[model samples]
Target: MLTLTHRDMLTLKHRDMLAFGHRDMLAFGHMAMLTLTHRDMLTLTQRDMLAFGHMAMLTLRHLDMLTLTHRDMLAFGHMDMLTRTGTC
Candidate 1:
């Protein structure tokens, strides 16, 4: 089995974010609003992780502004994940 360390995961997540273009973001939103496949779930997980990590750092610096966006992402990410996984 292959395993990824934290640093490796970060690198992969960053790469994924870069690979996801503006059009892809729109598609992701559409997918989130509807249904996601196993592959989409994996992609979303990576994207959300990258966003969450970024938001965490920003939260430390700009608490008021970034916090709201951070919370929104968490809420939306969780809702989407939960609904898709039947865990909600």
Candidate 2:
């Protein structure tokens, strides 16, 4: 199983720091990290973190069956929606 520690979270300050893996779950972790950033939670609030994390999982889960292009579009579209909604 993949485990993410607090220190792991801290080191993943940028998307470039995310490591791509062979497993789907690990790839999802990369996407989640892209959604969440260090500046996003420098104060490290659990509530905010959970909210974003939940959204990332849900968004990816629903898009899992789609083609990569479609999935990418919708995933990024979700991000755009979140931004416009002031949720990001």
The models' CA-based lDDT, in order, is 0.23, 0.28
Which parts of model 2 are misplaced by more than 4 Å? 1-30, 35-41, 53-77, 81-88
Per-candidate TM-scores read 0.16, 0.19
Candidate 2: pairs in clash: none
Question: Quick one: best lDDT, which candidate?
Answer: 2
Q: Which ten residues in a row have the lowest lDDT in candidate 1?
A: 58-67
Candidate 1 local lDDT, 1-88, one digit each (tens)? 1222233222222212223212222122222222222222222222232222211211111111111111122333432332121221
Could you give candidate 2's per-residue lDDT for residues 1-88 as a string of tens digits? 2444332232333322233223222213223433334333221121122222322432222112222211122232333323212322
RMSD of 2: 14.5
Cand. 1 Cα-lDDT: 0.23
